[model samples]
Target: MKELERIIHDDSNGLDYILVGEVYLPLLAVPNETREIGFYGSLHRNYLKDYKSGLYSYLSLSGKLWSYLADVNEQCVERRDYLMDQMMEQEGITEELKSRDQMEWVRRANNVRSRVDEIILNEMVYV
Candidate 1:
């Protein structure tokens, strides 16, 4: 446990043990305890800056929801590029279908980009 603490403290891996110790573990200790929610809320209120910083760091560490969003964003970009290429090709294709497909791809790409930007903005504001 001491070694774990030392590692958690020293590692730049961005683990927030304070959240773990103050909020998560206590909740885990008594899964059915209603008081755990209040304890977590109190911890968040008392250590707002630290809690936000920890949350931002955890999100930026590239494994949780942020990572998944990033991966999906990349995929969206790739698909958009492919669609653009297809639309640009001189092969015989209906103008209507091509325009529709291009619009759809652009819309999907923009949506993913917007979501990723929102996540980043949220993290920045919280931190």
Candidate 2:
């Protein structure tokens, strides 16, 4: 327990236990008989369960959700790259399709790149 306290207090490995402790501290301060105590206690217990094991794992729900979004965005970019490669290969072999529709394929590929840029800027930069 002392080691946990030391790690939490020192923000070791960028763990922000101060944030988690701040939420739970007030519950510990209030009398147990109070009506709200049980509710707050349950919430604190949930926090403990969620955060007790791993270092730097106590991020709020929004942070976790954003992390998930970033992961999905990465996968989307990878798939887009693979599909664009296939399209480019097809364009090289097909003269009619290359003449009439290559620019459209370029536009779609640009759109995918733009979406990946937007995701990196908006969703991944902060996370």
Candidate 3:
């Protein structure tokens, strides 16, 4: 979270990077306006997902944002595959479809994709 804040606030990156990262979704249903929502939940996911989602949602802003999002997505894919591979090796599971753990991974991955897509699509733009 601190890293994200730093990246968003850092003046060295110029307005585009700072603006994209600084934008966030607020919790509309909450009684207190101060409550905020983000691309990722702090209680569960690491900051990478939040960071990636931020970049993804802001793709319309500039080509630079799109490229950054792509890079983040690529890194996420590699990380996901590496985690699955490590799990399979440790469990000695050769068959992806047959392994319950692998299937769980697939299910979770799909759910996350859908969720992030929804989050991005429903993002609020402030003037």
Candidate 4:
């Protein structure tokens, strides 16, 4: 009788298995992504799972889902910030006004954020 090796590879399935104590378990590797996904990324992830299941599966299998989501999050945050700044400037939403009328500033900023969120969802997440 021969003892089984610590690690073995199957030729037919091309999978590697490792002996853990008394059991041989398939060796699975985690995806090589370390990006911290935030709200936008989470939204995109849900959208992918719900609306684009095939694409979500492909991305997950290919180990590119995290990086892709991180990229989208970064792009959305950057675009939102840039647009917010531009809209603020155009709408005269200055710090001086904020200091003078805090309530009005809050209202305008809330409106800007709402618009940005809608645009981002339509262009990135829901698509």
Candidate 5:
């Protein structure tokens, strides 16, 4: 009757509950994080699942895995960009080089990309 209110707040746990049928169920909803978990996030997720099971479990259980992965993805992307810019500047990989010696530019660009990828994997993604 009066005790079965439509909604309620619990001070002990600081949570809200909605009355559903004969029980009050804890209100829950998925977070509205818009960032997509890209390649780096996927790599980090796999590493955590395979090697860091305890941390993975804690993050998943606490409803923070997605947000954490998204943040990692952002950081990885920024790091990749910064590294690429530095390597490109140092190697003189430019539009002029790309237009003139296409093959050489391709080779150097590929090397830079692979190196940057390895650095990110070891420094950010895997650990």
Candidate 6:
């Protein structure tokens, strides 16, 4: 388990019981690029069905959050891919390379990042 998971699991505070599931659900979902994030506790067979039920509950309760997170993850992947391409281009390999592809990817990545960043930052500031 990750250090964060360990900390959450070992926490004795009341807050742990309240927020542990919430925190880990998003963390697991984000890293795995999965919209279904409530299955972390289903590693054991006993909890498998319960895990699915929890997943359904989470999705029903916060489908928008999952969609937003997935979109953000997609944008991040696009940005990383574009940056990798830019690095490759800068290394002077151009004969078979397509500048249009490079430009489009970079622009898409930047646009996604800018929009998402604006939304997130504004929400943070106002909240």
TM-score of 5: 0.79
lDDT of each: 0.42, 0.43, 0.42, 0.88, 0.92, 0.43
- Model 3, stretches more than 4 Å misplaced? 1-62, 96-127
| lDDT at residue 86 of model 1 (Cα atoms) | 55
Work out the TM-score per prediction: 0.27, 0.30, 0.31, 0.77, 0.79, 0.27
lDDT (0-100) at residue 4 of candidate 1? 32
Q: Per-residue lDDT tens digits of candidate 3, residues 65-112?
A: 434434444544455556556655665555554475777656655555
Clashes of each: 0, 0, 0, 0, 0, 0
- Residues 28-125 of candidate 4 have per-residue lDDT tens digits of 66577888778899999999999899999988866688999999899888988988998888999999999999999999998988998888888877
After TM-score superposition, the amount by which residue 4's alpha carbon in candidate 5 deviates from its true location, in angstroms, is 11
Best by lDDT: 5
- Lowest-sum lDDT 10-residue window in model 4: 28-37
* Candidate 5: stretches off by over 4 Å: 1-28
| Residue 8 in candidate 2, Cα distance off native in Å | 14
Q: After superposition, how far is residue 48 of candidate 6 from its true place, in Å?
A: 27
lDDT of 6 by residue, 1-127 (tens): 5444333433453222224643643223222335532222122222323545564455534434445344444544455556555655665445443464777565655665566445543342122
- List clashing residue pairs in candidate 2: none
Q: Which residue runs does candidate 6 get wrong by more than 4 Å?
A: 1-62, 93-127
| Model 2, total clashes | 0
Per residue, candidate 5 scores C-alpha lDDT tens digits across 1-127 of 4667898999997778998998899886557788888999999999999999999997886578899999999999999999999999999999899999999999999999999999999999988
Better of 3 and 6 by lDDT: 6
lDDT score, candidate 6, position 51 = 47
| Candidate topping TM-score | 5
Q: What digit string (tens of lDDT, one per residue) describes model 2 on residues 34-122?
A: 12213223333344456552422432332443343344445545655665566556545344655789887567656655665555434
